[model samples]
Target: MAAPLTDAGEFESWLNDRLDSLEVDREVYGVYILGILQEEESDEEKEDALQGILSAFLDEDTMEDVCKQIIKQWTECCSRSAAKRDAEDAEVQAIASMIEKQAQIVVKQKEVSEESKKRKEALLAQYANVTDEEDEAEEEEQTSGNNFTGNDKSLFKNTNVEEVLNRQKQKRDQAREDAQKKKEMDKMQREKDKLAKQDRKEKEKKRTQKGERKR
Candidate 1:
């Protein structure tokens, strides 16, 4: 069965304290105790295992007499480990800060790129509008030029346009004069016909009165 996990903080603190108090020979006992702490099957077993390991170290006269040397060596090892941990933590923080700065720069670059794209799009739209207007104006000019060409062609269609126009004006004047003379002649003819009818009636009445006088 696996041993219960130790809290890193608690274990580091306990190890630091034990290392500070250890004598040279007591270090062997401390190492054994740490091993037992790592391997004990249960939390309850760890205390008993630590006592057993300590008892084995104290029984030996050589370790018991070298307590001061053990303490110095243990303290030095623990200090080295602490320094290494501090350096690693500093490195991690530095890398994290670099990553954050890079991310911020990327975000700013994207924003600038987007703004540039928008400006370019606006300019493109303006350019397109201008091009469209120019095309429309060109088309209108072409249409007007075509209309002028058609009118010019029509004006030149009559080969003797100037002579024909003069002739038409003369004919129109002659027709007007003729029409006026005809209207005057028709009026005179109507008056003569009315007088002839009156004369005929008067002669017929005289002839009838003479005939009655003779009868």
Candidate 2:
């Protein structure tokens, strides 16, 4: 048979004795304490809120001590949570800064590329103008040669002029072919370099992501 419970103090003393004799896991007890202490209420509010429940098994002085311990634990927990939030915010800011730098670099590279394209077009236009002038000069020479006499000396002069024009035409055609080949090679090399650079950037990006994940 169980003993009859009498006064409030006697009942609380019995409850405390029962709680002390219980076989509870330390980890589970810790989790339960943490759950109560981590509430958003202020220290005073939390103490007051738990007063009625704890009074069932704790005396005045013991309950006060328990409230103090809870407040201390709660303050420490809040501090740790705030520190974690600060670290995460700093990491996010660093990533944003890196992305901004990458964007700036891309913009600068695009500007350089546009400038190079413009320069190439300008050079091609200049080369075409020079070729046009040479053609006009060659036509004038042919017209003058046609007005010469049929004598041996004049015939020799006309023959020499035709030979010079033919040699010039052949040289011009060879120069054009060489220029085209060089342009193609330059374009191929640029494409290869571009691919290599892109690959390097991708590798670097992967490494950065891996490092971040590790953190």
Candidate 3:
């Protein structure tokens, strides 16, 4: 018997060898042999069946030995073909498993990214709220300082009391400067009014002397 064929290529090669030795039409007899081998039967049964089938088309004396050889070779070829198909199936399963693993990894990465994005947004929102609260507290502190008396030390806990006092001092100094400027302006206006009254009186006295001279 021929050694088992390793793959389809080796099976084809073995089939061609059989055709050459048998001196049979490759297309006709090759197909007939393949069909007989494909039948669900025991090795002896298939061999006997093929021997009987080919005897009508071939020399009876040579057909028995050739049919037996053909059965052995083709059986090995079938066994090898089955093994190859099993190996291809296993390879396809392995590739499918790898693809599934890669897809799972991608899904996990996306989940992690989405979780990180949510955490970042949450942190940003928290920070913004803190900033707004601080701004409002600062505004309240500044406005509350206007009503501050020397007795309220608790109100200055979140603010610098010395800085508020300095601002108040600066405002008082500005008010004093504005009051001084207004007082100076009033004194200048009073001096201008006195000078204009004296000039009007002198003009009236000159007109009275001219009237007496005309009389």
Leading candidate by TM-score:
3
Q: How far off is residue 20 in model 3, in Å?
A: 2.6
Write model 2 residue lDDT over 43-154, tens digit each, in one string: 7766775564467667899777766765564565556656767788999999999999999999999999999999999999999999999998887677667654347557
Candidate 3 local lDDT, 1-215, one digit each (tens): 33333454665577768777767677777766666666636778777878766787678778877877777777777787878788999999999999999999999999999999999999999999999999999877876776454545455643677788889999999999999999999999989898999999999999999999999
- Residue ranges of candidate 1 with Cα displaced over 4 Å: 1-30, 33-65, 148-215
- What is the Cα-based TM-score of model 3? 0.57
Per-candidate total of colliding backbone pairs: 9, 0, 0
Those runs of model 2 whose alpha carbons end farther than 4 Å from true positions after fitting are 1-38, 141-215
What value does the lDDT take at residue 101 in candidate 3? 97
Span of 10 residues, lowest total lDDT, candidate 2: 1-10
By TM-score, how accurate is candidate 1? 0.41
lDDT of 1 by residue, 1-215 (tens): 64434344545455656545544243454456556555656544754554445555354454444333333343455466677777899999999999999999999999999999999999999999999999999987886776545666566555468879989999999999999999999999999999999999999999999999999
Write down the lDDT of every candidate, Cα atoms only: 0.67, 0.68, 0.78
TM-score to true structure, per model? 0.41, 0.47, 0.57
Q: Report the Cα lDDT for candidate 2.
A: 0.68
